[model samples]
Target: MMIVTTDQVAGYEIVEVKGYVKGSTIQTKHIGRDITAGLKGIVGGEIKGYNEMMTEARKLAMHRMVQEAEEKGANAIIGMRMQTSTVMSAAAEIITYGTAVVLEKIN
Candidate 1:
């Protein structure tokens, strides 16, 4: 499937709107990683553990969104966007959303 941040995909024409599709997941900080993060925070450096966690979470959310689009018979997703929010003290929610659409080559 093709996904783009813009409303239109180059070389393709949108034929049908399958509606909006979204996927979200919540992730919490690991205790061990939190401790390491705290120490790193004191020195002010990149928190690799948390970074990796967020990256994976984003990928999962995007995958789910794509699955939904496919289920709707959409070949592409436009206006794709991602959002991150603090769900709780230790947890964060990642959301991926877009407009599912059928696209045809602009032959």
Candidate 2:
């Protein structure tokens, strides 16, 4: 399936607007990783553990959003966006959402 951040896709015309579709997941920090991250923070550097976690979370969230779009019979998703929020002291929620639509190639 094709996904884009724009309202329109090049070379394809939107045939059907399937409405809004969303997927979300909550991730909590591991204590071991937290300690390591804390140390890295003190030294002012990238935290590998958190980076890996967030990368995985984004992939999962995007996959789930795609699944939802497929269930809605959408061949593409437009205006795709992702957002994050701290849900608790150690947990964060990541959400992916967009407009589901069917696309036909322009000849």
Count of backbone clashes for each model? 0, 0
Q: 1-107 in candidate 1: lDDT tens per residue?
A: 99999998888999999999999999999998999999997999999999999999999999999999999999999999999999899999999999999999998
lDDT of 1: 0.96
Please provide, for model 2 over 63-82, each residue's C-alpha lDDT reduced to its tens digit, 9 standing for 90 to 100: 99999999999999999999
Q: Which residue runs does candidate 2 get wrong by more than 4 Å? A: none
Predictions: Cα RMSD each = 0.7, 0.7
Whole-structure CA lDDT of model 2: 0.95
How does each model score on lDDT? 0.96, 0.95
Best by lDDT: 1
Cα deviation of 77, candidate 2, in Å: 0.2
Give the Å error, residue 88, model 1: 0.7
lDDT of 1 at 53: 98
Model 1 TM-score, 2 decimals: 0.97
Local error of candidate 1 at 30, Å? 0.5
